[model samples]
Target: MPKSIVVPEGTSKPIAPFSPGTLADGVVYVSGTLPFDRNNDVVHVGDAAAQTRHVLETIKTVIETAGGSMEDVTMNHIFLTDWANYAAVNSVYAEYFPGDKPARYCILCGLVKPEALIEIATVAHIGRP
Candidate 1:
């Protein structure tokens, strides 16, 4: 049977109907994470770059909780309200994966939260043979 994992409470969330992660077939699927902090409040005030960093940090925590590291992330889906901020987000993203870059797709979309300019989710491979 596939096992589901719930990310710890203190971390950020999806802002609506979703768990942070689920582990199945040795692959961890993380939900899209916004810039929300431990208090469930938006962390980045007026900066998309800050918001991007915040979301990635939350994604990192989710990955770790699933017995995986950032390096284990095989794929990522990045949602952005504005593609113009790609460079802003990419700059911060580059810092996280310096050596091995995961396959990813970035798309521009409307976010349910007003303050969120970006959200990130990932699929990771864990429990290697």
Candidate 2:
């Protein structure tokens, strides 16, 4: 089967040259998603917890739209600019995927938007067309 791109309708628009997620061979490879709102504005600019929640929700929307769920996520790639916000980010993340968590790797990195405190990308096992 040919690979297909999944662009979530209600999530923030991509500010770069990448799709929200790419579906190929029953897997959805999500790009690094920034904490932007529907208007493409940075959300909760300085608040890591709030920004973390927003980004996760946005990722959820994209995964669900492509016929998957948080439970279907095989891996999550979490990116952050500062290590100081680690605890806060993890707190919010725990609330979202409390059980059967996916494999993940968290790393400190520089993001495109300076105001973005957290960015999350994922790989989900989508089982539908």
Per-model TM values vs. the true structure: 0.89, 0.92
Q: What lDDT does model 2 reach?
A: 0.88
Off by over 4 Å in 1: 12-14
Model 1 agreement with the true structure over 13-87: per-residue lDDT tens digits = 445778899888888889878888776777776688999888887788887887788888889899998878899
Q: State the lDDT at 57 in candidate 1.
A: 79
User: Which candidate achieves the best lDDT against the true structure?
Assistant: 2
Backbone clashes for every candidate come to 0, 0
CA RMSD of each candidate after superposition: 1.9, 1.4
> What lDDT does each candidate get?
0.83, 0.88
List clashing residue pairs in candidate 2: none
Candidate 1: TM-score? 0.89
lDDT (10s digit) by residue, model 2, range 1-129: 899888877655567788988998889998888888777789898999999998888889888878888888989999999999999999999998899888999999998889998889999997757
What lDDT score is found at residue 51 in candidate 2? 95
